[model samples]
Target: MPQPTPDRDDQARLFREVVLVLGGVFAVQKTDDETIRRVAAGLERVYRRARQNQRSTTSSQALAPHPAIAGLLRITEAEGDEP
Candidate 1:
């Protein structure tokens, strides 16, 4: 099983926060340039880490109780059509 790297987890939390703020601004139908810049900065940090290192076992995309990559599996008890 893979665990999330500390950095990535922090990024996810930060992203959630940003969304909250963005939503608030959107509710008022106002654009906050500063907020957008901050969000962009956060995304840049995430991208830099992703480019420099592979995801840890705990990356969000890799759900627990399931393998990180599902499409990699091509098996079934009964034959079924590919989605």
Candidate 2:
């Protein structure tokens, strides 16, 4: 049987936790906007590659990266692009 998907509330809570952790890392490391954006872009590339690998190997339902992750990457990339 397929596993049940997380509810929206659970997803939101998880997203918040992820954000908090990332924020703490940034604060602790004093990461600049450019570095953050580069990190995010690198992460996105890795995520996509992993997803492709998983899809090729698995017959089970395909998993997606969270929207919050995608959003964060997009925001960082966009911010880096700005002066």
The numbered model that scores best in lDDT is: 2
- Model 2, position 77: C-alpha lDDT score: 95
Off by over 4 Å in 2: 1-6, 38-83
Quote the lDDT for 55 in model 2: 40
lDDT at position 80, candidate 1? 50
lDDT of 2 by residue, 16-79 (tens): 6765787789989999999888867765654556434444454468667699778987997999
Return the TM-score for candidate 2, rounded to 2 decimals: 0.38
Model 1, residue 66: C-alpha shift (Å): 42
- Residue range 1-83, candidate 1, lDDT tens digits: 88988877986786678668766875687667787788678667766676467655664574443462244243432235645
User: Candidate 2 clashing pairs?
Assistant: none
Task: Show pairs that collide, candidate 1.
Answer: 2-57, 2-58, 3-57, 3-58, 4-58
> What is the lDDT of every predicted structure here?
0.65, 0.69
Ten consecutive residues with minimal summed lDDT in candidate 1? 68-77
Q: Kindly report which residue stretches of model 1 are placed more than 4 angstroms away from their true locations once superposed.
A: 30-83
Q: Candidate 1's error at 46, in angstroms?
A: 8.4
Candidate number of the best TM-score: 2
